[model samples]
Target: MTGGVVFDPLLPWPLIATLGLVALIGVTLALWRGLSGWALRALAAIALLGALAGPVYRVEDRKPLSDIVVMVEDASASQNLSDRPAQMQAAAEALAAEIEARPHTELRRVTVPDGAGDEGTRLLETLAEALAEEPQGRIAGIIALSDGRVHDIDRAPPLPAPLHLLLTGRESDWDRRLIVTNAPAFAIIGEPVILTLRVEDSGAVPQTANIAPLEISVDGGAAQRFEIPTGRDIDLPLTLPHGGRNVIQFTVPEAEGEITARNNTALVQINGVRDRLRVLLVSGEPHAGGRIWRNLLKSDSSVDLVHFTILRPPDKQDGVPVDELSLIAFPTRELFLEKIDDFDLIIFDRYKRRGILPASYLENVANYVRQGGAVLVAAGPDFASADSIWRSPLGAILPAEPSARVIEQPYHPALTDLGQRHPVTADLQGEENWGSWLRQIEIETTSGDVLMQGVEDRPLLILDRVEQGRVALLASDQAWLWNRGFEGGGPQLDLLRRLAHWMMKEPELEEETLWAEATGQRMRIVRRSLGDEVGAVTVTRPDGKTLDLALEQVAPGRFEALYDGPEIGLYRLQEGDQKTVIGLGPAAPREFEQTIATGEVMEPLIAPTRGGILRLEEGLPRLREVRAGRPAAGRGWIGLTPRDAYETRDVRQTPLLPAWAMLLLAAGLITGGWLREGRR
Candidate 1:
């Protein structure tokens, strides 16, 4: 469709120059010698030489592509917190209208969604993806309408053109939030753990009260009153009443003219564990099993055991008088009544009906069990006799009735099915290192969990709970052999330690309880049990949304799950009937503003663009164009970075001269000049 003049030289420049010199000499000689014909011939030869050079004419047509302008808009949770969303919407509408009015300029609008679940906002990533779809030369510029708080700033790509930001929000915006500075994942029961908290004031607080009354509650109980100085950190020491996940809620009463009460109250869950256990062991008569119980409990450092043994009876007549017997009088009333609540656990080791403890005292002991007290009875042959303690008023609290039957046999201690299912006894099953108890006492019972059995399938250990109290009955009187290392005795201390602690309403004894411990954003969900199987666990988030997930058993009685909380707040866990709530982040962190618009955050970035940061409070400005690189906003028009690009299929080019025509004109002129000179 088009052509142009181009050169194609066949000879070197030196040969061409030599040919020109010879033609010039011939023309000069003819003119000087008066030979006009010779001069004409020389000029013709020179022109013919110049015609050998190649030339052509070329023409072309071209098409121009439109320049692209990217408009990125951010509408996240933070943006919505203020009037930023409406501002962005208005700015976007006006910008679109302006870009549309421009000639040969295309607009690419990219809307970035809120970042995935608490990751904040990502605007640059969306912009980069939109840019990749188009050619770099076609892009004019990028304009972002948002608050500057971008969660994914690393995603910003190198811009081929200028980048501009249009900020949102006012200059005086601020916020206040509750911060839980310190909380432990675990604390000792009935022991105070120090928690650090702070109430911060941000921006313009309407009411500045010096002291704010803070109410603290544990496990949904009545809150206790405390006064904390506002705008400062306060350390509070709280004691846990019971073991397990202890939910503590701390709240500040709303003040007049307060901005928000959402951050006033915060929930914290601290798991309660036992630092030490106090146990009282009373023996009516010395027996092998009684000594074993004493040795097991006494060996543990965390267990404070107060053991009393009655070596003498009150009415016994002997050669030695009562005063000379030197036996300390057992303070039955003081121990069984006055100081009963002080001890966490009481064990009757082979105790029988003695004249020392009256019927009323035994009745009081039974009442103690009904009132959340823990009692463990170790029975011997005396249990089957007329002197059995089961015949006393304490009989009502006994897990089993002593029958007048004695089963004398050597048998290995075993775990029953329900015992293997219970948290306290399940850990004893399949243990290879424990020596078998050779002797056991026969018992009859309609209730109580049969945790261990002896030879011939006679129950050896029984455990039960009445009211809020716990009871453990060991039917064997020959367990002392294991404690004395009679035949490779093993783990005697460990077994008794677990048994006593479990009876004292320990948190670890719960067969099914949901508990979560957190460190920063990382959380560990643990389920302690004595059962062989547990159903799926359902976790409730702070937002009241429930997530059901199956758990993996890590050990015989422990199941655990690890999770990272998306945002800091209280979270609940449930498995079947067991449910526990724990705080992942602060009941409220100072920074959890849910709105996603980035107008406030982007103000600094927008300042460099020389663009006016106007609110949607005002009407949207019409888009106007200024010079490509100069100030874009002078009067009414906005500036856009220019991207110059053009395409061509054909081009036209002109040559300076034609070789044959030049040769003819040169020969004629030389002949004329030579003839004139020769005539003169």
Candidate 2:
């Protein structure tokens, strides 16, 4: 208990002098001619009047409330990196015990959890929330246990009392991290994209330069290795061969003298799509489906399709002389050989040999297929006739030999056994509204995989893999019936798109390939195949653990499974013999950039408040009592400021001596004074 006397009214000297002025005025009026007796009487009256002014002093008993001590602990990802986690745990326990030992003091522990998706740790935010619940006067001091890498520094609350930092890591603790300085979200297919990356050494760097070899793999294949300089940034140019999400994994062999290999590897998923796909469509004769193919391809803004229809062949000569003909000669050699590489895809729609293109020109077309080029043949009834282009030099590369037979029968275009598994024609189960093709061409294909079949099990569509390229054959050439909705056709656009993408080496179309997609914290593992069943899928996350999962078929040929990652990081997947890597989080975090313990981050707050910072390793400082609004710690030492908060469980009030009592006392004194004066 404590008690003190305080004045109710303490007037300054100026107010006292003003009262004397009024007395002097009264005396001068009473004795205008040099009055000594009146002046003396006036001074005595002034003294008596000053004593009558009400001034009171009272003492109150008070009991101080318990002080509040805040303890902030960092529980972020970086805190769990090395021995820092154990160190922090130990320090937190010690600080809590010490704060609890203080008399009449309560401890408020604030836990800082890891930020979501590379946002880093928010230490200041936790402290501010803890402070809002307690009274400012009851707060004694604040203690923080962290790596000093807080992302929410701007949210630090105004210090109600002294703030202290008890840092968590040792001085010799070091780290090495991979930094992707530059990466693009989209890159042109088959074009090289330049990426800027670096390997940085923090804290205590290794003495030896130990330049490690950097290996890069696209969609998880054999990695190409290159020597990279250590402790500095380097530029790497990478080319993507196919379209869609191209997963590129960059890794450097773990150096002999490095801290952790976590930062030695990085994964980037960039969308690889063609800037423009140039296609040459040669149509021997105009048909309904021919216009459909042209229209569908032309609608896409990314496709550049050049359509050419032959009105007449060069060998055709009527009764009129060659001079009478106004047609210009077709540039066969220029298109097939001279500028062949410029076009990405070439389509021969019902094209027949007419002496317009020599056998050597056809041989050049076949050679183009052997050198990583794509070609497609759309055959009609003429493909089985004597004028078939297959009889030319291109026969060696043709997957099917046309039997001289024309089956003029209506049948629904059907998918073969393998077609149901192929990505292009798979899952096009048009059983609900099966469409019909009016015409069917009889063709005998022994070597190629039949994808679509028509009338009497005749091969309608055959797909073949040639030397370093892909070729597709459509036997009937009556696909235009689907475009015209001959028998309630389904989505014709979908079929054509899948076929084109499949021929372009889309990763999703591979018979045995591993791929992963992230959907807001969960990753979906997908494996596509042409076979009836796929082997088990294996997954390797950023944490370096492999998990083999049995795939469940969701569609006709697609298998998928969901894997929930514990945290945001890179993940790798492997199914059968294929592998892929992808990043599920942002590049880096602000706190992970610096794992060392330092008060530098909070130095500005500490210096202004006259608060001292003491490390846990240096031992906790003794609690001290200091004046309010004064420095809690003086000169090179640290201390806590105590606030004297009194609790009033019950207060008593008493108003003594009424106005009538004062009036009665004044009347008696006046009467006595008058009697005394008369007696004198």
Candidate 3:
């Protein structure tokens, strides 16, 4: 119960003040004239004025409220390292027990878990939500159990009571981490790109741990070791060996006293792309299909096209000078000898060995294919003639050799069994309506894949890989009929683009490859092969555990599997001779990025509230209660504020003087003073 004095004026304050001022003036005048009743008049006037003020004695019945004490628990992944989780559990239970044993104190437990994606630990955000629910005046204290590796430090809310952090982890804790500071999203194939990375040592590191052994691996191959200096940035120069998504892992061998090996490794996936597709088109004779090739090549912004058409053969020696003939001599020497290796792809559109290019030039073209260059041949009826380019040294690299026969029957093209399993022709199965080719050269496939068959099931399209380069041969020149919308057209554009890109070694068009792409926790894995029977893929997780996943055929050559990852890290996928690496959420999660714990992040917020940050490494400090504006923490103990808050259950008020009592007293005093004045 609490008691206080309150007022309830009977009349307006202005009128009551005027009446009192008039009485005071009259008493002052009487006192100045030596009136004997001046004292009595002043006493009666004082009591009357007191009655008008309506003073009341107020007594309140209040029930004391329980002071709320909040306990914030950090259950993030970082806190689980070493014995920190155990430390947090023990500290939280002990703190809860102490707060519970206290008289009229309520304990509020707020748990902060590991964040999804790369959010790490949003400790402050969770604490703020808990603090917002309670009245600030009733909060006696807030205690946090964390590793001090909070990600949202800037979001700490204004604290009302003393805030204490019982930090986990030992003073001797140390950690080594691999940091990928800068990485590019895409890099040109066969070109060296610099990746910025570093290996750092944090916490109480040893003196001899200045150098860490870094292991680097591309895809899922064997790791290569290098000694890298700790605590400094290092630029790693990498050249993508193949085109497509390349997974590069930079790791450091785990050391003693380190928190975890999760941070010792970092994964980076850089997509490999061709900077330019340089195509050289050689034409022995100009035809309608030559324009199709030119238009297709010219349509792509990344392709640089060079066209050379033999307007007049060497045999057609017209009676005109070379200059006057309005023809520029073909630079066969420059194209085949000077800078042949610089070209990415060479196209032979009905090209014949008509002495325009010497036998040496043909041999050089063959050598170019063997030395990592792509060649595509669009055969016509002339390919079956004795003047065909197949008679030259280029025949060694060609997939098919014509038998000097041309079949001139209109027939629709068809995909062979191998084509159904080849990425280049996989999507062409059961095409709605295909255009027909009127002429096709008869040829036998020798050391190449027959992707398409013509009349009598002859090899129409063949793809072959030479030494390091790739080659393709098309037996018909009537593919343009599809482009012209014959019989509602066929997939002519799609087929040509795929064949060209495949010859150029595009990773997406590889006949045999395994790779995975991820969005958040969902991963879509793919396996491409040319064989009809494909086996399951073996996936190795970041922890060296393996699982075999059976693939489902999505398309002819595409095998797919969808998996939801339970954790964030690098995943290694392998199918037959193919192997690749992929990162799910992060190569190294944000939670493990900095595993060492410290109290600097919450010091600013704790300081303003006179709170103390004590580490559990030196034994959990004892908790106590303290008054506001005083020291809230000491060497061996932490303090909570004594709120002294209460709820008023009932209230009563009684007037100090009743209206009748005030009137009788004022009249008796006035009458006694007047009679005394009259007698005098």
Write the residue-wise lDDT of candidate 2 on 1-680 in tens digits: 33333323235556756776777787677578543355445645544444444333344556779988888888987777667788778877876787799888889888999877667888888888889999998988887778777888788889888776766766666666667789999999878899998977677666665465788887667899987776777988888877888877777766554545656667788899889988888888776666877887899898899787787776565677767778656777789879988887888898888778889888888888888777788888778889899899877787888888877877777777788877887767664577877776677786768988888888888878888877888887777777777779765677777777666677667766778888867888888877778888777766678888888999877888988776566676777677776667643445556666678888787777767666655554555666656776643345666776778654333323233454455455555545554565
Of candidates 2 and 1, the better by lDDT = 2
Backbone collisions counted per model: 38, 1, 0
Q: What is the lDDT of residue 590 in candidate 2?
A: 53
How many steric clashes does model 1 contain?
38
**Residue lDDT tens for model 1, 1-680:** 53456755446767777877787887687668766476556657656665655454556676777888999887655566556777788788878887888889999999887666456677878887999898998887778777667867666676666566666765454445556689999999878899998876554555556677888888656889987777888898989998877899887776665544557778877778778778889887776566777777877787888889988777666778667766787988789889988888999888888788889888888888888989998888888889898899878878888777877765667677666666776666345666767666778875777877776777778888888788888887776767787556765666677788878877767666667788877788888766777877787776668887777888766788888777667776788777777776557543343222245554444445554444434444445454455554434334576676667766766555576577678767677765765686
Best to worst by lDDT, what's the order?
Answer: 3, 2, 1
Model 1 per-residue lDDT at 376: 90
Superposition error at 523 for model 2 (Å): 1.3
Stretches > 4 Å off in candidate 2: 1-61, 204-215, 225-233, 252-261, 286-290, 306-308, 319-326, 358-360, 392-399, 414-421, 426-431, 485-490, 587-590, 614-637, 666-680
What local lDDT does model 2 show for residue 47? 43
Residues 312-420, candidate 3: write the lDDT tens digits: 8889966888877778888889999998988999999999888889999989989999989999999998899998988999999998888998899999898888888
Error of 1 at 37 (Å): 35
lDDT for each of the candidates? 0.73, 0.74, 0.88
- The superposed Cα distance between candidate 1 and the true structure at residue 648, in angstroms, equals 7.8
Could you tell me the lDDT of residue 205 within candidate 1? Answer: 55
